[model samples]
Structure formats: C-alpha cells, structure tokens
Target: MGTALEDSEIYQKFARITDSLLSPEIEDFKDSGGKVVGFFCSTVPEELFTAAGMLPFRMRGTGSTSTELADTCFTPINCTFPRHCFNQALEYEFEFLDALIVINSCDHIRRIYDNWIDQLDEPEMIHVMSLPRKTGDRQVDWYREEIAELKGKLEEHFGIEITDDAISDAIKLHNDVRRLQRELYELRKVDRPPITGAEVLRVMVAGTALPKADYREMLQELIGTVRGLEGNGDHKARVLVTGSQLDDPEFIELIEGQGALVVTDATCFGTRLMWRRIDEDEPDPIRAMAQYYVHDRPSCPRMHGDQPRRLDFLKELVEEFKVDGVIGERMNFCDIWQVEHFMTGGDLKEEGISFTQVDREYILAGKGQLQTRVQAFVETMKGTD
Candidate 1:
C-alpha cells in the first residue's frame, strides 16, 4: 500500500478495534503493568512523565451516556467531554490510570483537581499543577515549584527518581511532534492540500498514544508528500469547526470530503494548541505556559472569565479563513460546548454567517447522519435552493 493507504488501513483497523475489539485489549494493557498514568493539559509538559519509563496516557473524555460520578462535583455547566472521560476514570473505565496529573488550565478542570483529592479521597491518584499566569513573571517560580512537586509525586509513585536526562528526552519527543503537526497544518493553509481532515485527526490522536518522534516523522512525510498533489476535489462550501476536544478531525473529513473546505478551527485539539508556542529563552518555562493557558481562544464554559474577547477572536478566524459557514460540534454530554455552541453561533448568525451544529460522540457512532446533515447544510449555504 502507498503511505496514505497504509495509514488509512491502519486507522481503519484501530477504529474497528475501538468499535469491535479493542476495549478488552486496552483493558489487558492497563492490567499488564501498574504503570504511571499522567494527564498534561495545555501548557504543562507531558515529557517528564514519558521520560520516567512509565506508560503515559493523555486523559480523554468518556462516551456520551451520562454518569453520576461526574455530577457529584462538577456543575451542570461543565464541559461534558472531560466529565464523561474523567467519570470513566472514577468509575470502571480507568483501571489503568495509577495517577492523574491535572493541569489547572481552566476553571472547571482546576476545580476538578480538588474534587478528585477530597470527594474521591484520591490523594494517591491526583497530581495538580497550577499553570502560570500570562502577563507576568510573578508566577514562573510558582509554576517551576509545581513542576518540581509533580516530579516528586512521580518519583514516589514509580519508586524511582526522575533524572534530568529523562526530562530532556521527553521534552524532545513532545516538541518534535509539535513541530511536525505544524507542518501538517500548513498543507491545508495552501490553496490545494492533499491530506484529509480525518487523516490529520488520526495522526494527532496517535501522537498522544504513540512514540512522538516516530509520529512526527510520519506526519512530516505525510504532509510533504500530500502537498504536491494537484487535488481536483470539489470544495464549494467553506467552513470552520469550533468545539471542545475535537482531536479526531473527523468533522473536517466528513464535511470536506463531500464538497466543503474546512479551512480553520477554534477547537482545543487544533488551533488552541496550534497557536501557542513555547518561548525557549523565557526566564522560566512557566511564562510560555501561562500565555497558552490564559491567552488561547477560550471556548469552554469554565474559561469564560474573560470570554468577551473570544467572540472577536472567532470573527478574526472567520474573516481570515474566508469561511462560508461554521460547524459547532459539541460532545454529547458536554455542558460547556452546549452553551458555547449557542453563544458563538448567535454572534455569527446575527452577522449573516451560515452555520450548523453537531453533537458528537467520542467514537463517532452517528457520523453518517452528521455527514448528511452537513451536506444539506452546505447545499443550503450554496444557495442551491
């Protein structure tokens, strides 16, 4: 198979496994070693966790079906993605996560850290890190202190001290992946790009679970190869996706494959990460972190402290991206997206922008239905009336 075909086949296999067989396999893997499980959000580095010779898994949300575990602590307005995923951790789905490294990037997630410690009595399973504040160096020391503290926790958990070399290696792995992802993103920025939205998402999710260096190389090669193709595919409707934890890029794939250009994003799994950069020469790493956490476009309900600015941010993307429509994807049980969907779209619609809303499941069970809806929406937007 060609690289694209091979990669597609691999994803098809994993999706089937995710659908038909992988739960038990992942369960088995979880059981094989009582290894360390870490969660790094936005700015906090995940490199250290990987360097410790521990199986580091990024925290993902659970499925759409509701659970009482999350309700005990979080309000009804919290984003359902994290609630569902974290609830799974609290319930039966997370037998493998020895500990959760929670980054206090936004309000609700930070609050969740405390709930995990107190209500769940999960002192052993929770490591909280307060992200640095963007406008100042005052918080850098505090962030470094938190990093140091997390290192101590990992040491105690694994019964081994983390070495400086391990930290450097882990940072290199994650940083390399970031570099490649940036290149992959550039393909779409070009007039005619080869890779699909689904392909992009597949590579990104794999980055979380696979070895970063290899992942980066494969992505860089994929983009480099794809950019050369003079894609003659039809793409009349132009759209941008805005949502929470929409890492799969399936929305973009589904809509664009039919006849739409998914040109930009406001999704955490995409632009939110894509826009932020780590300043190598900053007095402390926390400075870069603080900027990412506080300054990235805010969409989650919990991050609404300074949210008046996000509306303008969305407008900037719409204008710059030349978007003809917007697709607001909400996690099925996500309280935050549910709210933001209405709020953001309301602002755009009033200005005569075309848009649609999709409530998605983690596994993308109802994608065919979503595809049909988007196609119809695109037709309407095109004035094919």
Candidate 2:
C-alpha cells in the first residue's frame, strides 16, 4: 500500500498534513491575508466561511500525542479527545487561527469550547452555536436563523460582505468536493481496494484541514491516479469501523495491519463528514446548508430520536462495502458512544453482523493489545466465512 502511493504527490501532501496540527499550505494561505476560521464539528456550516472568502479548518488534536498540559486545566474524568485539543492549544499549535467556532455537540466538547473561550487569549473571535438535539421543521428554521446570525457576525468581524453569489459558488465548490470523495470511496467496493483505510482516513482529515478548492483538486487527481493502479494484496477480511473521534490515521493503520481491511466507517471524522451534499437548486443557499446539515447529514448520537436512523445507515454501509464484520471502537470516557455501542450491539446481532466493541484512549498507546484483539476478531471473521 505504501509503495503504491509513493509517487502520488496528492496522497503525500495529505499524509503530511495529518501529521501536524497546522500545515504549511494553510500557513501560506493565512500569510497571504486570507482569514482562517477554525471549527470543531461538521455541524458548523463551512460553506459560510468559504463563501466569506475565509478558510474553514476543522480543528483536530493531531500533532500532539500527550494530554499532560491539558490535564492542568481539565480533569481526568473528561474525555481525552477534548483534553488533547486543549493540550495543543496550550502548546500554541493553534496560534494561526484567526477565529474559532464550536458547536454544542456533547457535554465534554461544549465544556472544551467554554474553557477555550474563557481561558485562551488567541483566536481573536470565538463563537459557540447551540446544535439542536432534535430534528424537525422548527429546528431547521431555528438552525437557519442561527446560521444567518453567524454569517452576520462573520461579516461584521471580518469587514467583508458574503454575497449570495459567493455562497452559491461556495456550495458548488463544496458539493464538488463531496462528489469526489464519494467517487474515492466507490473504489473501496472492489475485492482488493487500491487504497487502504489508513490512507483514506488521512485524506479525510486533510480534507477538513486545507481549503476546499485545494482539497477538491487533489481528490480529483488522486482518484484518477489510484483508479489507474492495481490493488494491494492482504485484503483478508472486509471490516467496518464505528465509534468516537478517529482523528488519528495510525489507529486505522493498526487495524489494517491486523489483516482486516477497513472498507468503511461511521466515525465523525470519517464517512460522516462527506457522505451528503447540499442542494444547489434551492434559491436560498443558507437555508439549504442549514437543512442538509441538520436533517440529511449522517446521524450523530448527540442528535436525539435518531438511533434507528443511525443503525439503518450502518446496515447500509455494511451491505454496500461487503463488510464481513464490524468493529465498534470508542474512547474510554466517551459517554455518548458508550451507550450507543451497547445498544447497537444487539441491533447488529439481530442482523447477523459480526460486531465487537473496543474502548481505548483518544491517543492510542496500547498498540500491542489493540493488534491482538483485532487479530482475534479477524480470525473469528474468517472462521465465520
């Protein structure tokens, strides 16, 4: 797999970005007077920032492997994902952020936003938007209004007007990126996938880090490059991964190293980021962005009354990817996935999908244990086959 992508500059660039919290390309963009907005979740409408001519960077706790500094501000009871984010902030890894946005996705993340805003001095502009837990007409309307309000704030702070034409163009650009991402995933459906899951996760994380235009072109080129190549061997078992924040591609590599190829996943940073597209035909781009993110985007456990919807999506992925088994991976202290995984266990069993749950810290340190469990699971999957 490594040799296959060695000559591909697009794959190499994205892989480099995944290794750091901030990339040289982004620094160059900001250096050229482009405003960069740092956002936490996909719930934040990135099209708005791109339309406003600012770079929308999805905040990842990459580059830093320890939470030592973050522990001073937060407790051990808090999930390591957010804590690691704080750790990076304290280390000045996110000093390039001109503005930051956070959504009310979970208790720990909400608290992370609060702490960042109250504790940090950088990120001159900080905003927190409440993500409604339910789905409906009223919620959609409210979310649109919230998006409008955010747009207004951005306009006022940046002294730039985000025109309708700009938003329309931004939507088109983002939609193209989604289309390319979907096409990339389609290549995985083959018996021997050309690209590995670890590489896919790195590309997905890079998609959130760099500008849309840059990522879109790279994805297009990479897709063309990979399709012309042959698949790497050792695709012993097709597996689907689901769970908490998977910001690290090394985690995916660990599973792939265990001989099970991860064909697809339901992680927040993985498939959920690019599976859906915004409707461009809708005259109101803002309303379209708000509606799609709230209703049509991949279901998160935080969204109440969507458990069945999430399971249905999981089942569809299993069948679509020809997955032989499912791995329910979660962080140790993540309450949301803890319960969601417990409930999903039976639902997957009823469908006869081989499911296993493994909990670890956000920054995985137990590669030996994880590899052992993954090996056992791969053997079990082969036995079933």
Relative to the true structure, how large is the alpha-carbon lDDT of every model? Answer: 0.62, 0.87
Clashing residue pairs, candidate 1? 61-85, 62-84, 62-85, 80-334
Q: Candidate 1 residues 268-382, lDDT tens each?
A: 6666655544444444443343433445324344454444566677787788667788989876666656777787788789988987898876545677888788888888889
Clash count, candidate 2: 0
lDDT of 2 by residue, 248-267 (tens): 88888889888889889998
- Model 2 spans with C-alpha error above 4 angstroms: 1-3
